[model samples]
Target: MNYEFLRCDIENKVATVTISHSPGNKLNTQVYQEITQIMGELEANEHVNAIVITGEGEEAFVAGADINELADLDTVGMMDLTQITRTSYSKIENLNKPVIASINGEARGGGLELALSCDLRIASEYAQFAFPEINLGVIPGGGGTQRIQKVVGQGTAKELLYFGETIDAERAYQLQIVNKVVDQNELSSTAKEWARKLAQKAPVALRMMKLAVNTGANVDLESALTIEATSYDGSFATQDRKEGIAARLENRKPNFKGR
Candidate 1:
């Protein structure tokens, strides 16, 4: 399918979605709509097992939202925009297949929020992260406040959001926001490597694992354990489980059909 704001390329069971708005790749209403639609398509595409998200240029992963688009909005319009943004980001976070953010450069405001929605983040050495919404007299509305706190803890999340200060990739790694940091030249290849590795795993098991972790994160310990156990038990019924065991005994590589 054609997209106005992004490009989706699939290879070796990995789908890479590039935000192609150019320059800063700032998110506007069209970007949000395209993201939502593309994510849904990727989720339903049987051949896709992993997904990667990144921006088009060298200067920014995504600089922020389209400030020009936001500048003319009334209160109701702002609410509508935030709702769409939140829904789009939520789709990324809850995708059955794993999603990785290959953050190449600056990620500020809604851009940082978008990265936070991914299952994992791999940032380039030149990448920077911030929630600069406060500068515009607003706060993050696209799950940033909640997701960042979950990843980096409350105090650090508060500091980043309140002060609207940008942190380098190293600092973000230290804060546990990004899973890994590499040179800018290696960012795309590294992200693809990880995504391909993920694609080679048992799809059903990975889906259950992701489901368990995402769902359990919000519940009590006992409830979380119950959810995990349920997911674990459900995995045993898949054909992939039998193939995995048979391959182990035969000393051959397992062929997973995502069944």
Candidate 2:
């Protein structure tokens, strides 16, 4: 599908999605709709084993939501907008393939929330992060409150959300919000490298592992264990699992057909 607010490219089973709504990449309802469609396409594309999301330019991954659009939103409109964005974010979170947020620059408010939904985040040295919705007389509406706490601690999430404070890449790395912080020049290469590595893994195992972790996170320990066991058992039935075992025995690389 043609997209005005986003650009997508796929190579070697890795799909890179770049938000280009504006220089700051501030998201709006239209962007969320586009994201939902893009995600659906990626999910159906068997060749796409991993995904990477980032901003178009170096100035900002996404500064926040478009204030102009927010200014016009009434209570009902806000709720609708929130639902749309939340659904889009949830799609990224629940995708069987791993989604990596390549934070090329500042990611604040909704921008930060988008990154939080990803399975992993790799930020550049120049990148910054914040949950500044409080300053706007609103709070994060796109699963940020939950995901951030999962990535960082509850205390840290509260402090950041309550104060609307911004942190640089170093502090974000220390807080465990980002998986890696690299020089700006290396940001794209690093993110792609990670995606490519994931793409080469046993596809069925990758999907099942993601399902186990995400589905188990909200359940009791015993239930979570059961979920993992179920996923593990299902993986054993895949042809890739047999190939993986055979390759290990032969000391050769496995060519998983994503079965």
Candidate 3:
């Protein structure tokens, strides 16, 4: 499908979705719509085993929301916009395949929120992150406030949110917001490499693993154990499970067809 603000390309079972806008790749209504649409297509595309999201230029993964759009919003408009944003982010967060954020540069406000929705984040040395919505006399309308705390504890999230300060890639890695940080020149290659590695895993098991961890995280210990048990039992029923075991016994690589 055609997109005005987003570009998608698939290679080696990995889909790379890039957000590109003239000024800082800021999130807007159209961008959100295109993202959700692209994600839907990717979800159904059997060839795609993993996904990576990033910005067009090296300057920013996304600077924030488009102030041009935000500036024109009334209270009702703001509410509607926030709902759309939330739904779009939810689509990414709930995707069965692994989603990685190749954060090339600045990720602020809603941009940071977008990155938080991904399963993993790999930031460039020049990358910077912040929730600067408070500076605009508003809070992060997306999942930033909640997701950030889940990844980086409440105290750190509170400090970052309250101060509206930008943290460098290293600091973000230290806070566990980003899984890895590499030199600016290595960012794209590193992200693509990681995506390719993830694509090599058994597809059904990868999906189940993500589901088990994400679902378990929100429940009590006993409930989490139950969720994991279900996932574990479900995996054993797949043809890939037998192939994996037989390959191990034969000392050969397993060929999982995602059965």
Candidate 4:
């Protein structure tokens, strides 16, 4: 399907989705709808093993939500918009395939929330991050309040949220908000390299791993252990597991068909 606010390119089992909305690539209702649609398409496409999300230009990965749109939203309209945005971000977080956020530039408010939804984040040295919603007289209406604390701990999350300060890529990396930070020119290639490596792994195992971790993180220790055990058992039943073992013994690369 075609998208007015997104540019998608698939190659080598990695689908890179670029947010193309101009003037900071701000997220809007239309963008959220397209995101939900594209994610479903990618999930059903067997050839796509991994996904990458980025913005169209270097100036901003996604500056934030469209302020103009927000200005017109009433309480009910805001709630509706929040639900749409939350659903789209949740789809990214819960997708069976791995997703990497290639943060090329400023990722503020909803943009940071979008990045947080991804499985991993690789930011360019030029990239900046913040949750500046407080300045707008509202807190982050997206999943930021929950996901940020999970990644960076409660104290740091609160500090960032309360202060609404912008952080450089190095500072973000130090806070463990981003997995890696590379030179501006290397951002795209680095993200693609990570996605390609992930795509080469056993598909069933990858899915199980993601499921176990995402599910386990929010559960008790005992429940988390059970989830891991179940995921392990499920992976063991796959043909890809057998192929992996055999390839190791034969000293050859495993050819996983995602079975």
Best by TM-score: 4
lDDT string for model 1 (126-213, tens) is 9999999898898999999999999989998999999999899999999999999999999999999999999999999999999999
| Whole-model lDDT values for every prediction | 0.95, 0.94, 0.94, 0.97
How well is each residue in 1-259 modelled by candidate 2, as lDDT tens digits? Answer: 8899999999999999999977599999999999999999999899999999999989999999999998999999999998999899999999989999999998999899999989999999999999998988888999889989988889999999999999999999999999999999999999999999999999889999999999999999999999999999999999999999999999999999999
Per-prediction backbone clash count: 0, 0, 0, 0
Better of 2 and 4 by TM-score: 4
TM-score of 3: 0.98
Best model number under lDDT: 4
Models 1 onward score TM values of: 0.99, 0.99, 0.98, 0.99
Candidate 3 per-residue C-alpha lDDT over 1-259 given as tens digits, one digit per residue, 9 for 90 to 100: 7999998889999999999897999999999989999999999999999999999999999999999998999999989999999999999998989999999999999899999999999999999999998888889989999999999999998999999998998999999999999999999999999999998889999899999999999999999999999999988999999999999999998888899
Off by over 4 Å in 1: none
> Where's the lowest-lDDT run of ten residues in candidate 2?
20-29
Alpha-carbon runs more than 4 Å astray in model 2? none
Question: What is the TM-score (0 to 1) of candidate 2?
Answer: 0.99
- Looking at model 2, residue 201 earns an lDDT score of 97
Number of the candidate with higher lDDT, 1 or 2: 1
- Clashing residue pairs in candidate 4 (N, C-alpha, C atoms within 3 angstroms): none
Count backbone overlaps in model 1: 0
Better of 1 and 3 by lDDT: 1
